[model samples]
Target: MDLDSLTLAYAYGCRNAGDFAINEGSLALLDRTVPDVDVTAVSRFASESPEYERMVEELDGVEDGALVGGPITYDPESQSRPAQLAALARNGLQYGVDVAGVADDLSVHSALYEGITDADAMLFNGGNAIHYSPSHGNLPYLLAMLYPLQVARRNDVPYGLLPQTTFALEGVARRLVVPLLEDAEFVMTRDAITFDYLSEFGLSTQLINGVDTAFLNGTPTAGDPSDGESNRIAAVPRFSTLGDTGELDAAGKRMEDTFLTYLDRLVDAGDEVTLTIQTEIDAAWAERNRDRLDDIGVGYYESYDPDELRAHYAEMDLLVTMRLHAAIFALSVGTPTIGVYRPEWGPKMDGTFRTLDIAEYAIPWDGATVETLEAATADALDEGRALSQHVADNVSLRNEALVSDLRTALSTADGFA
Candidate 1:
C-alpha cells in the first residue's frame, strides 16, 4: 500500500448537519484511494456534545449482528429513531470511547484527538469555530482544535484540511489554528468566499468550491412537488445571543410584514415558515417566528437528525436558509436554495451562491425581508421544474467536479509530503 493511515479530527455537534457533512465527506474522499485503511470515528463531537456518550450507551444494548442504513435508505423505519441507532450500528467504526460499557480505560473524548499527531497522514474536516468569532462567544472549541494540530505538527505528519470555515478569531483563531491552516501540507475550501478570506490572511490554498460536503449525502429528497405552490416561502429565524435582538426583531418585523403583503397579492401563493433549535442558544427567535409557521398552518419541520433531515429540503421547492448544509442539500437534490447571509462572516453560503452563479439566491442580512423571501420563493415554486433544472445544472457540475478532484487529490496524496 502506498499509504497506511490517513487520520482525521472531526468537530461539530455529533450527527448534526455539519458533523454529518464532515464525516461523510472524509469517508468519500478516502474511499477514493485508501479503501483498506482504518477509519476512526471520534467519540466526542464537541465538548458538551453527547453523541459519543450517547452512542456508547446505545452500543451496550446492541445484540450484535446489527445493520445500520445510510440516511437515504428508502425504508420507513430508516426515517425514525430506530434508523438512527441502526445507522450507527452499521456505518460507525469503533474508535476511542471510554463510556462505561467499554472495558477500555481511556476516556472517549480524550482518545478521539489523542493519537492523530503520531499518524503518518491526517485530515481535519468541517470543524466548528471554538476560536470565538464576533457572533459566537469564547468556548473550548479552539482548544480542542489547537491540541490536535499541535500534536500533528510535532510528529511531522502530513496534514490537510477539508472545507472548514473559521471565525471568532480575535484570539483563538489568530494564535491557535489559522497558522496551521496556512502552513499545512494542503488546505481546501468549499467556496470562493472562504478561499478568498483565508488567502487574504496569507494561506497558500486551493479553491475547490465544493458543496457543504453533505451534498453527496445519500438521503433522497421526496422530490415531490405535490405542494409546489404551497411550499414557496421560507423564513430563517434569528436567535443571536451576542447581537441586538432589537435589530433582529426589527428585521423580522419588516420581513414578515413584507411576506404577509405578498401573500395577499398572490391568491395562490403559499406562506413562509421558520426553522431553528428549541434550546436557549437561539430559541427566542425560533419561538417567535415559529408562530408564523403555525399561524398560517404551513408545512414545517424543526431540528432533526442529519440523516433524516434531508426530507425537509427535498420537501421544499425553495428554501430561504441560514444553515449552510440545508442549502447544500437543497441544491444537490435539485431544489434551488437561497442562502440568507450576514455581513463579514457568512462565506459558506455566500460563496456557494457566487460559485454556482446563483447570485439571485444570496439573500443578505440587511437586504432580505420576509416579504422578499416570500416573493422569490413564490416564483420558484410557481416555476418548479425550471428552478429545479437551474439548481441541478449548477450544482451537478460542482458536485461531479469535486468528486473527481478528490479522487485525483487522493491519488496524488500517495507521495504527498
Candidate 2:
C-alpha cells in the first residue's frame, strides 16, 4: 500500500496571523516528518475573503480546500425555517443520517460536507476552540465544531484531534464531545493538565501526551547581539472580555492595567519596546493602549508572514506575551519568552509553558504586578541562551513523538493504500 497517495483534510478555521503560523508550521512539519501525503485544508471562511486573505496567503505549505462558514449564525433572527430545514437535509446526506444535525445553516454545512466527503481522514488542528470555556459564550459554536468529528466517525474515516489544549467538559458539552472523542482514532492534548482533565472522563485509550505543533518550526538563528545600552523587548497584549458584552469587567480591566504598567516599567528601564500584534483584536488593543503610553516610543508590528514575524522575535532580547503563539513563535526562534497566563482563556498558555519546561516564566493574570513582570523579564534575558538551548532540545523530541504517532494512526486506518 502506498500511504503517500492518501489524502488528508486538515480542517480548522484560521482566526488570525498566529493561527496561520500554526497551520503553516504544521504543514511544514508533516512534509518533513510524514512526507508525500496530499493535504487539503478546510477553513471556516473563504481564503480569499478580505478579512482573512493575508492569513491564507501566509500559510506556506497548505493547499486550500473549502470555506465552510462558521457554526454560529451572525444574525440568528434572519434565518428562515425552510432554509434551515433544507440545510439540515443536505448535512444529513453528507455526514450521515445518524449524526445529529446541529448546524442548520447551509453555507457552513455545504463547505464542511464537501471537505469531509472528499477526504480519507481528518486532522483537527491545534487550538482551544474544541472545548467549552466559561469566558466564551458560544455553546452553539462549540457544537458546530464537534459535528464534523461526528461526521467522520459515522462514515468510519480515521480522524484525530492534533496537539491541542482542552478544558474540563461539563453538562451538555460533555455529552456531545465525549462520544465523538471515544470513537476517535487518536486524541492528543498539548499538556498533562488537559490530558489529566480528559482522563477523568475515562477516555484514556484515545488520549496521548502531545506537544503543540508549533514546536516543529525551524529554530531561528542567532542574530546580532543587542548593544549594551538598550535591550529590545517584544510585548503582545489582548483585550479581555467576560460574558458577551464588549465591555471589560473588573478582572479584565485589572489584567489590562497590569499589562500597561508592565510595559511602562520596561520603557522606564530604558528598553526599546514593541507591541507584537498577531490578530485583529490585538491590533485594537494596541491602538487603544498607545495613547496611554504617551510618547514612550513603543513600536507596533503586525505580520502575517511567519518568517517576517520570526525575524521580529529574533531581534528581541525577550518577549512578554499573552498570546500562546506569540510565546511559541519566540521560543521556536530561540528567543526567550515570559507568558502572561489568562486562566479565563482556558489552559493553553500555561499548559504550553509547562510542556516547554518554562512554567516559572508564566505569570498569572489575577495578581500580576509590574515587579513580577520586571523580575521574570530580567531572568529571561539573563538566561536567554540557556533557555533557547533547552527549547531546541525539547522541540526535537516532541516533533519525533508527534510524527511517530501520526504515522502509526494513518498507516493503521482501515482503507489506507
Candidate 3:
C-alpha cells in the first residue's frame, strides 16, 4: 500500500527551538518520503502559540493548511490528570480495563480526537521528551506527551516513533510506558546508546538506528553582525550538570567554573561573547548565575523560534555550548562549535559529533577544562569553513538514509492502503 492512502497524525509539543528544528526536519523528511501523505500536527498546548504558527509557515516541506491542535486540554494546576489516567490505563489494560473508555475520557481537543481516530497511523516527531531526567522530574509532563500514543492504540491505528534521543526510563516510568512502546509499529533512535538502552527491554517492535532529523535542515546563510569587525562567539547553557537533586552540586559548580574561565579567556582574546538560552530552564540558570555573567561581562541571548535562532547563530564566529541542539544549530549555520556536556547526559553529543567526523569537539563535562575548551574552540575556528561543507555533505547522506529507512518502516507497517 502506498503512503498516499494514509493519513498520519504527527504528535509533538515543546517550546524549545531545538525541538522545533527537529520537527521542521521531520516534516521535511515526511514530505520527501511520502509526497502526498496527509498529516495533522497535534501539539500539547490547547492553542497553537504564535511561535508555533510562525514555524509552520517557515518550514518549507510541511503541507499547506495542515491542521494543528492538541488532544488533551488542562490548566497548569492540574496537568497531571492525563498522565495519571494514562498510567491507570496502562496498568488497567493488564486487568482488562476498556481501552476505548480510557481513550474517550482522555481526549479534549475535537480536532486532535478526530485526527487520531480517523487517521490510518500516527508518528511522533522531535527530540527526547520521554525520559525521566533528574534535573526535570516532571513525570506528568513526560507521560502526557504519550497520551496520543494511547489514543492511537484505542483506535487500532498503528504508530511509529521517529528518531530521538530518549533514555532513563526506569521504575514507574518504565512500567507505565514499556507496554506502549512494545505496541509501536516501529521505534527509531538517533543515537546508538539509546538504541542499546531500549534493546535491553527486548521489545519485539522494529527498532531502527536512525540519524537525527535535525540534519535534514538546510544550512542557513550567515548574517552580518552590527560590528563587522567583531569576533563574535556564543554559548548555550543547560543545568543538567547540577546533578540528580537539581541543585548546584560540586560537579555542576566545576562545570560552571570551567566555562567561566573559558569565557574570561575569550574576553581577554578580544572576542565578543554571549550565552544563548534555548529554553525557560536555561533562563532560570542564567538568572541564578547573574553575578557570574555580570563579572565576565557576558550577556545572554534569547530566541524562541528555531529559524530565528539559526539566523542569530549564523552571525557567530564560534560557539561553545553545553546543549546539543545549540551546537547543532550553530553547526547548521556554519558557525564553529564545541560541545562541553555532562558525561551522564547520554551519547547525544558524542553521537552527533562522531556522525560529523568531529568527535574531538565533544568534550565530557568531567574531562573538560579551560585548556580543552580553548583548544577545541581554536580548532573549530580554524576548521570552520571545512566543517560547514562537511556538515552539508553528511546531512545530505544521512537524510537520504533516514528517508529510505522510514519508507521501509511505513510500507511494512500494519496500516496504509
Best by TM-score: 2
lDDT of 3: 0.70
Residue-wise lDDT of candidate 1 within 1-417, one digit each (tens)? 355666666533333444545555556656654576655544333223344444443322122321121111112222477875664453233321211124434543244434463356766665333335534443433453554555466556666666666554555457766667655766667777666666677655433445556666543322446543345444344333232223445555565565444434433443444353312333455456556545555444555354445555666556666666667656767776767666544466677788778777787768876567666665666667776776777676776676776656655643342
Candidate 3 vs. true structure, TM-score: 0.80
The lDDT for every candidate, in the order shown, is: 0.53, 0.67, 0.70
Please give me the total number of clashing residue pairs in predicted model 1: 8
Per residue, candidate 3 scores C-alpha lDDT tens digits across 1-417 of 555334334434345667667877777788778777776676554444554465555555546656465534444333488765674554344213222434455543355556666666778775665776644666756656666677677678778888877777888888877888899889888876777778899999989877778766757433333355557899887765422235676888887788888898888887889888887678878888899788888867898667778777887877788888887777666566788777667678887777667788889987899898888877766665677566656655666778998988888877543
Candidate 1 residue runs with Cα over 4 Å from true position: 45-49, 55-109, 127-140, 167-172, 202-208, 218-236, 241-293, 413-417
CA lDDT for candidate 1: 0.53
**lDDT preference between candidates 1 and 2, better one:** 2
lDDT (tens digit, per residue) of candidate 2 on 1-417? 254322333333334556666666667656865676676665544333443464454455655532333322232223488766665555446434325444544443445544565676677777665677544666755755676677677666667777778875888788888888887777878776787778888773467788777767757444344777788999888765521236777877888878888787788889999988877667767777668866666777887555677778988888888888788777777777888876767788787778778889878887478778888888877776777777666666676887787667556645453
Order the candidate numbers by lDDT, best to worst. Answer: 3, 2, 1
Best by lDDT: 3
246: Cα error in model 1, Å: 13
